[model samples]
Target: MDTLKRDVLSQRVQQVRPSGIRKFFDIINTMPNVISLGVGEPDFVTPEHIRQAGIESIQQGRTRYTSNSGILELREEIAALFQRLYGLTYDPLSQVLVTVGVSEGVDLAMRTIIDPGDEVIAPDPGYVAYEADIIFAGGVPVPVPTYAKYDFAVRAAEIEAAITPRTKMILLGNPNNPTGAVIPREELAAIAKLAIEHDLIVVSDEVYSQLVYGTEHVSIAAMPQMQERTIILDGFSKAYAMTGWRVGYVLAPEHILSAMLKVHQYAIMCAGTAAQEAALQALRHGDADVKRMHDDYARRGRMFVDGLNRIGLACSEPRGAFYAFPYVGNTGMSDEEFAEKLLFEEEVALVPGSSFGNAGKNYVRATYCTAYDKLEEALIRIERFVKKHA
Candidate 1:
C-alpha cells in the first residue's frame, strides 16, 4: 500500500500556539510540593448562597437547557448589574446573551464582528487568548505594545497609531491580566474618543472590574456616546469566586447581540441550566462575598508587590486583578530562563512574561491569588533564587 498522508486539523488550529500558562501548569502537575502562582483563579470557594442556588436548581429538576439567550431572570439581573454599577442600560430581551464564560463571549464577539482580514487592535502582554481568538475567527490581531513604565496602560495614541482602514475593533482587558494595570478614567475617555473617531467597536473585558484597589474601574462603554459602540464581557467567575461554575454574559447593542446570539445558539445552545441559576443568585445576593474576596486580594497584592520589590524584582503595586508582573531582568536571565530555574530550584511555579507577548520579554507573572501564607513562602524562595542569580 502507498504511504497515507493524514492532515487532520484545520490550518487555524495548527497555527495557534498552546497556552503558555498551561505549560507551567503541566510541569507543576508532575512535581511534588510545588507552590503555584501562575493561574489567575481565586483561592476562595464559591459563596454558600450561590452554591445552594445551583444545588436547589438540580434538586428541583431545573437542569434542562435554558432559553437560547439564557434564563430570562439571569439576563435581567445582568442588565441590572450594569445599571447599578455603571449606569449603562440595555434591554435584557434584546441586548443580553449569557455565555459559557467570558472566554466564550470573547470568541463569539470576535466571530460576530470580524470578517476575514479584518483587524483588531489590542494591548500586547494582554490575556493570552485575545490573539488566538482573533486568529481563530480569521481576523488579524494587531498588538500595540504597552510598557511597564506606564504600568502597562494601553494608551489611546498608541492604539490610534495601530488602527488602519481594516481595523474593526479595540479589545481591552481593564484591570488587565499579567500586569494588573487599570486604565485611568481619562485614558479610557481618550481611547473612547479614538474608537468614536475610527468608528470601530470596543470589546471591553471587565471581568476584574470589581477587584481593583485604590481606584475605580471606569467602563469605556459608560463614556458619553460610547455605549452604542461597546461590547461588555463580564461574569461571576472572578468577583463571585465561581470559576468552575462556568457562566458569563455579554452586553451589546441589540443588532450586534442578535448576530452573536445566532453564533452562540449553534455553538453552545445555552449556558448550563444550573450554572445560570447559580449566576442569578450571584447577581442577586453575592455583593458581600465579592467585597470580602476583593479585600483579601487587595491586601495580598500590596504584600506581594512589596515583597517583589524588596527581593529586587522591581514590580509595581498592582491596582487590580491578582497578578504581579515583576521585572526579572535584574537577575541576568530571560523571563523564560528565570521561570524555569525558579521552578526547578525552588519549586515555585509562575508563567514567563514572554508567554503573554513580546512586550513581556524580561518579566515574569506571579499571581497573588494563592493563600497568603503560600505567597509569603513563594516570595522567600524567589528572594533566595534572585540573590544567588543577581
Candidate 2:
C-alpha cells in the first residue's frame, strides 16, 4: 500500500506536535450538544457586500487565475489599508504580497528565511500556528513567556535574553491569541531597537489589528529603522470575518517580499480569485462593517471578562482581539481537566491554557467571538459549573 512511509520528513516535521487547540476541539465535537468557545474565529458571517462581491466574481467568470502576488487592485487595497489604519506605507508593487491566509503568510515568511538550526523567538502563550510553522520551516522556536501581571505584554529584556548567534527572527502576535494583550508604543519601540541591535527580522502577526477594544495598534513596520526588516502578517480573516475565505497578505522589504513571492508562486500560486476580490470589497466598502464588528467585540469582551471575574475566575480585560483568557485555578482541576469538565458539565468548550504553552498552563482561552446570548449563557453555565466544582 502507498501508506508505507517513504523518506524521513526533513527531521522538522516529526518534531512538531498537533495543534493542542484543534486536538481538544476534535474531542469536544463528538460530545452531544456542546457549545464551543475554544476556537478564536468570529461567529459573524462575512459581510453581505463582501460575499456579494465574491459571488459577482464567480458570475463574471473572474476565476481563471489572478497574478501570483494577487490582483494588483487587491494588493493596492491592502497597501492602502495599511496606510489608512496604521499610518504605515507599503508599496503594492514590491512591498506587499497577498497570501492564501495569514497561515500561509506565516508559512511563506518562515520558509523563505529560515535555514536549518536557525532560531525564531516568539511569545510563549503565543499563536499556535506561529510555533508550528517555525518548526516546519526548520527553525528552532524559543518562546519568551508573557505573564498576567503585565497583561501579557512582551518584555524587551525577555526578548534580549533569548538571543543567540542562531537567532534569526522574533515573531510577535500582538493583541496576542490566548491572552489578548497588545504591545504598547514604548514596548514596540524597545522591541524594534532590540531587533535592530541584534540584526534580527521582525515578523509581526497583526491579524487581530482591527479587533482592538479601544487601544491603538502600532505597526512595528511603522518604525523608521524597523520598516525594512519587519514583515507584517495580516489579513481579512480577523478583521472582516473572512476566515473561511483564506485571504491574508505579507508586507516586507522588497528582497524578502521577492523571496516569499517565489515561495508563494511555486507552492500556492495565488490566493483565491473570488476571495481576493471579496477582501478588496471589504477594504473598500466595509469600513462601517469593520467598525461595527469591533464595537460588538468590545462589548462582548467586556461582558465575558466581567462575567468570568464575577465567577472568581479573573480574566484580564482584553484590549485587543475577541478572546478572554481566565485563570481556571478555582476549578480545582488541571487545565485539561478543567476544560473537559467544563465541556461535559457546563456545555462550554474552551482551549486549555497548556494547549498554548507551559506559561498558559493554569488558564483557559475563551473567545467572545461567539454571539452575546451564547456568551451570556456560557457564562451562566460556567458559574454553575464553578460552584459545583468549588
Candidate 3:
C-alpha cells in the first residue's frame, strides 16, 4: 500500500507558525468562568446607526458585487478622511483600495511590493502577523527589537541599524498591537528620512489611529514626500467596534495601489457590499460613537494598567490602543509558563509576549477591552497568581 505524504503543502506555508493570538482564545473559550484580557477587540457592538445602515443595505438588495476597487462613495469618504485628518490627498478613483480588513490589506501590500529575497524591516514585540505575511510574500522579515526601556516604541536608529542592501520596505503598526505604543512625530520623521535614503516603501498600519489617549495620532504618510512612498492601512474595526465587519482600506500612491488592486481583485474581488454600506455610514455619522468608545477605552486602560503595576507586574501606561504590556519576569516564570499557569489556576487568560517575537519574552500583553468590572476582577486574579508564583 502506498502511503500519502503529509508534507505536500507549500514550503512557505509550512515555515510559518499559526496565529498566536487565536490559539490562546481557543483555550479561553472551552473554559468556564474565565476572565480574559486576551483578545484585542472592542467590547462595544457596532453602533446602532452603522448596524441599521448595513440592515438597510441588505433590505434594499444592494448585495451585488461592487467595482473591484470597491464602491466610489466609500472610497471618496476614505479620501476625505485622509484629507481631513492628515492633510494628505489621495485620489478616490486611483489611489484607494478597500480590503476585507487590515489583515487583507497587509497581505495585498506584501504581495504587491515584495519580490523574492526582498527584506522587510519590521519592529519586534510588534504584531504577530507581520513576519508571517512577509514570509508568505517570499520576503525575509528582519525584526528590530523595541525595548520596554524605550516604552516599546520603534526607533529610527534601530531600524537603520537593521537595514541591509536587500531591505525593501518598512512594515509597522502605529498604536501598536501588543505594547500599545504610539511612535512620536519626531521619531516617525526620522524613519521617513531613512526610507527615502534607502528608497524603501513604508507600509503603515494605522488601524488603531482613533483610539489614542492624551495625544493625537499622526500619519507618517502626511509627512513631506512620504505620501509618494507610504501605504496607509486603516479600518473600522478598532474605531467603530466593527471587528466582524471585515472592511478596511489602503491609501497608497496610484502605482502601488493599482498593483495591490490587481492582487485584491483576483484574491477577494471586493469587500462585502453590505459591509461597505455600513462603513459608509460609519464614516459619515459615526463620529460620536467613535469618540464615546475611545473615551471608555481610555478609562478602562488607565484603571487596568494601574491595577497591574500596583499588583507588582510593572505595567507601563500605554498611550494608545487598549493593551497593557506588563513585565511578568517577577513571576519567576517564562512568558508562556506565566500565562499558562495563570489560565489554569486563576481562570484568567492573557497572551504571552513571546508570541509577538523574541523581543517580547519578558512581558505579557493584557488587553483592557473587557468591561471595567471584568478588568478589575482579572487584575485581582492576576495579583493572586503572581503572588503565589513569586
The most accurate candidate by lDDT is 1
State, as a TM-score between 0 and 1, how close model 3 is to the true structure.
0.98
Please identify which of the two predictions, 2 or 3, would achieve the higher TM-score against the true structure: 3
RMSD of 1: 1.1
**Candidate 1 lDDT over residue span 26-99, tens digit each:** 99999989999989889999999999999999999998988999999999998888899899999999999999
How many clashing pairs in candidate 1?
0
- Tell me the deviation in Å of residue 151 in model 1: 0.9
* Tens-digit per-residue lDDT, 1-390, candidate 3: 988768678989988988778888999999989988899888899999999999999999999999999989999999999899888889999999999999999999999999989999998988988999999999999999998877899999999999999999999899898999999999999999999999999999999999999987899998888999999999999989999999999999999999999999889999999999999999999999999998999999889888888998887768888899999887789999998999999999999999999999979999898899999889889888878777
Residue 142 CA displacement from its true place in model 2, Å: 0.3
Root-mean-square deviation per candidate: 1.1, 1.6, 1.0
> How close is every model to the real structure, measured as TM-score?
0.98, 0.97, 0.98
